[model samples]
Target: MMGHAHALSGIVGWMAVVPLLDGHEFFGLRFDLGPGEIVAGSLVCAGAALIPDLDAKSSTITQTYGVVTRGLSAAFNWIFGGHRNGTHSLLFALLMGGLTQALALWSELAVQIFVFLLLGIAFNGLGLGNDKNRLASEVINAMGTAAVTLALYASGVNYAWIGVAVAFGCLLHFAGDMATELGVPLLWPASKYRFGRNIGFTTDGKVERNIVTPGLTIAILLLSFYLFPWPELLPQA
Candidate 1:
């Protein structure tokens, strides 16, 4: 799915986790970012949410992730056993998280970049979806969620509940990626289960289900009133 489409659909798909997370608001994790920073963080989170689609190569969004990510993704796919290896694995997410923390300790700027970018990768891992490797996928998602929430709180949105909401919301992005037509390597190093990632279309966002993303995203944002109660005043999701 494209960013806009992913933005919309992700909210709905990740909703599945609501039951697992219970009443906790996972995606609303607020960071201390000023309006600008919050915008950046949200964008980063959304981008992270979309990272898993790069493998398809046919996807415009995936191609846009850049040659480094794309090349590395391809190489990783070859070495780690497609969606079932390093990229989709929890071990990988931890590795990335640990790396992010270490980098964060290096400098404030580094922390922000690492936090956002690494979270993106972790989100991609989570969105890999029901790929027989749910364990790996969940681990990555957990780590990604923690990293994102920590950043949110550390940045300034200190409410722990908000962090939970942030985690839940971001995971929804990953899940949304599942419904795409290509596939998400949700689990790595254990199972190669390609999650949803199919909005009726195959590549290029030309599928029938693509029509559902906008409505789905709006629905999710609306549902957040009862579920999260966060103030997303932008009115421009």
Candidate 2:
């Protein structure tokens, strides 16, 4: 799947799970999330949905950070046996979620530092112009966006849910890939099993554009309405 498709899937997945997490139980555990937590989770999931594709240099996520992601992507490719290996695996998802949870202990500081680093990457990657003045302007813009994000965090947003959202987003990425012809290695290291072989259309194929993407988009819109129904739709008393 493409970057936008994966992002849509992640958002839909997060929204679908929100209601379940609010008062439902799963595997002997329960979640009681509030509105702010749900928003944070959705944002994190949407952002992390692009993480698996970091291995591909031409991928949207990679280009977003430009050269800053090269080393990390290379490291991942080396460790996971290239593009669709470990990074797309269930093990990777669990590890990422656990790491996020651990880091959430210093949520405020962690978020601030992360925002700063991300802005720095954006400043370098925006490809506005090589001129010093243009570069400086882009940097300022990136910093301004980061500052706004930091302010939002300081305004009482819960960061713990971010980790959970990222984990779920990665998992949804795997699921989206599974719908492609190439499939994904759901289990890695222990076995080289590639699941979802030929189950759906090829990458960027006609069916994907005409059927899958549109279907997912419609589902997302419907789910959004289900989650937050309009007041105008209420019956008149």
Candidate 3:
């Protein structure tokens, strides 16, 4: 799937899980999410949906951070043995989730500094400023994103939920790739089996653009309507 497709899938994936997390149990565990948690979780899930593609420099996730992500992408390709290898595995998802959780637990200053650095890289990658004012623009964008993140954190959003959202996003990415010709290695290092094996349309194909993307979008809208407390807004007759 392409970048837009992956993003849409991320949102749909989050919505698909919302009902399960709200009033149902999965693997013998249930999640009782509040409204704030649901919003935070969905946003994080959508953002993290691009993480798996970080191994490809031209990918949206890498392009967001431009040259900053180039090195990281190269390193991931090297260690994971190219795209759809280790990074697409369940193990990688778990590691990413753990790392996100740890970072979310850091002190306010630490979190701010981390977000600033990440946003700086992202802004620079996106060509926000020319050589003359690049540094200034990077600082401004980084600070802005960091401030927003901090405000959300202070507004009763749970950090653990953010980590889980990211993990689930990656899972959805892997699932989406499973439909492609080059499937994902869900269990890498230990098992060399690639799942999904030519199950869907090619990446960025007409079918994907016209069919799958629209289908997922409709699904998301319907799920949102069903899961959200719409009855509260109904008029008393």
Candidate that scores best on lDDT:
3
Candidate 3 lDDT over 1-237, as tens digits, reads 877677777777887787667756555445667655565565566666767888886886676655777888898889888877899999999988778767877664554454444433333333344256756765666666566566666775544454677788889889888876767888898998988887878898899989998898798788778777767746767
User: What is the C-alpha RMSD, rounded to one decimal, of candidate 1?
Assistant: 11.3
Q: Which should have the higher lDDT, number 2 or number 3?
A: 3
Model 2 / residue 198 / CA error / Å: 2.0
Question: Listing every candidate in turn, what is its Cα RMSD in Å to the true structure after a full C-alpha superposition?
Answer: 11.3, 5.4, 5.2
lDDT (Cα, tens digit) per residue for candidate 2, span 1-237: 877677767767888888878777565545656554554555567667777877776775665654677777877778878898888888888888778767766666886565445333323332223256855755665666576466556666656455677788889888888888766888877778998978877877898789877887798788767776457547877
Looking at candidate 2, the ten consecutive residues that score lowest on lDDT are: 121-130
Q: Rate the local accuracy (lDDT) of all candidates.
A: 0.47, 0.69, 0.70
Q: In model 2, which regions exceed 4 Å deviation?
A: 24-30, 112-155, 229-237
Off by over 4 Å in 1: 9-41, 60-62, 83-86, 89-98, 114-174, 180-187, 193-211, 220-237
lDDT per residue for candidate 1 within 32-82, as digits (tens), equals: 323334333343444545544444555433443367677866865676565
The predicted structure with the larger TM-score, 1 or 3, is 3
Which ten residues in a row are the worst by lDDT in model 1? 157-166
